[model samples]
Target: MNDDTVTATPAAPAAEPESMPAPEQPAATGPGTPDPADPATPGSRRLLRAGAATAAAALVGVAIGIGIIKTQYDDPAPATAAAPSTAPTPTASATPYGAKSNGSHFGSLRDLLLPVPAGYRPGPDDGVYGNDTELNGEQLSAELDAELQQIPKDKRDKLRSYWEGLHVKATGVRTYLSTGDDLVIGLKLRQFNQQEVQRINEYTAVFTGDTGLFRIGPSIPGHPEAHCYLMPAPPSAPIDYLECSAAEGDLLVIMNAEGVAPLPKDKIVALFTLQLDRLARPGASA
Candidate 1:
């Protein structure tokens, strides 16, 4: 946003009044007596006419003086001295209206995805066929259609209608493996309408909150909205699994971890934190 400065202009000074000629005075006359030669005399009437002219001139002068005084009182105040010239300090531009922390985003959704970290190579692409890790709208729609195949037709139709209302826009995915223990980390980001993205957290809580099949996982510190769930493996099973999801802006961030019975809970939380941080702070390096 830019700052606006309002400046006031000084009013011009009122013009000075022009000088007026003084009227001639009438000659002195005795009470009840008139001089024939005097213009103000009753016979000639000149003295009376001269007296009237003098009085009119005086009245005009008085009126002119009053007008000048009123004009001075109504004039605007004088302008202040100009400010000193100096280099302007730069200011950061305001964030766009539709772009906010954990509410909305305006840039490429794929750009907001967390970058592949050190010691981990790019995981298998989740897009249709051998497509890139980033999925376009059409590809995502096809994937959804495939997933809906297992459900009954009526239920699938209703779910599809609900999904359509979400207006999913894009998706990004990355999978990587640790150098040791063969631990695999899969990350998926889905961008949709903000309202639908928010509902993901609520849905995850209801479905994964207290199911006997999965144990409560570690909470993402500093991110109360994020939730994690761990599937308890059978005694003879060789691997354990964990899933975490968070609603960040218009993106639903998901992480799936599979490894030996004892998954690195700390590392999982740390990675999830990094991904969430990336979404929250668009300027930060992925």
Candidate 2:
């Protein structure tokens, strides 16, 4: 049984062992080529180290280039930066009111002159009518309170004297205008001959420039030919004043304002001159 079992076992196929993967072969090389698997090859080692160093250098160069670009972009922009005008800007006048400049009569002396600024409405006229001597003092005084006259009494009398000899017929136009506050514009126009014109040129008056509630009048600009004075603000009286006297041919013009005019000196003068221009035009008597 043992001999038969041995024969059968021999007859049984030889036992097969587990298969193993083959070793990776080193690549074939030319006579001068270094073996990549050989760690002892100095030339191969140097080539690998050099390649790694070049790659590192390339990465460093790329980083430095990016840094340079970032620096240029991050630079800050340049950092020095002109005052803003305070004059009254009067608009053009309304049709009928503004039409005085074209040599048209405005019915009465009150209608002829500009009462307030261009945009405002004219107020009531409170004045009188007469020839020069009669119109000069009593009529004007009656119209205004005697207390309103800040000039010394004699000076006021002296002013009356200027009209004593002048031959002229005049109408006084007085009215108030609503600015931010209210104001009065007074105009006394004496229509006359060459003799009266000569009288106006010959007249002269004094201003003491006194300090008190009274401020001496300053000469209005653009009136080298006219005599003008700016008066003080009347206490609780609700007004300051300016007076201008000028005589053109056949006309003696007295322009007065009872308020601190809301205008620069030059602009006020320009406006006054414009009024005069209108009155002096032919067929447009003040």
Q: Which residues of candidate 2, in runs, are more than 4 Å off?
A: 1-117, 127-165, 172-176, 201-222, 232-239, 260-267, 281-286
Evaluated with TM-score, which candidate comes out highest? Answer: 1
Q: What is the lDDT of residue 173 in candidate 2?
A: 40
Inter-residue clash pairs, candidate 2: 240-259
Candidate 2 has an lDDT of 0.33
| Model 1's TM-score against the true structure | 0.58
RMSD, candidate 2, Å: 51.1
Task: Report the C-alpha lDDT of model 2 over 242-282, residue by residue, as the tens digit.
Answer: 55666555554665454333323454465567767655545
Over 182-284, each residue of candidate 1 has an lDDT whose tens digit, in order, gives 4666676767767666654555555456434346889998788788876544454345567787877777677766665567898888888887887774443
Model 1 misplaced stretches (Cα beyond 4 Å): 1-102, 125-132, 143-151, 281-286
TM-score of each: 0.58, 0.38
Clashes of 1: 5
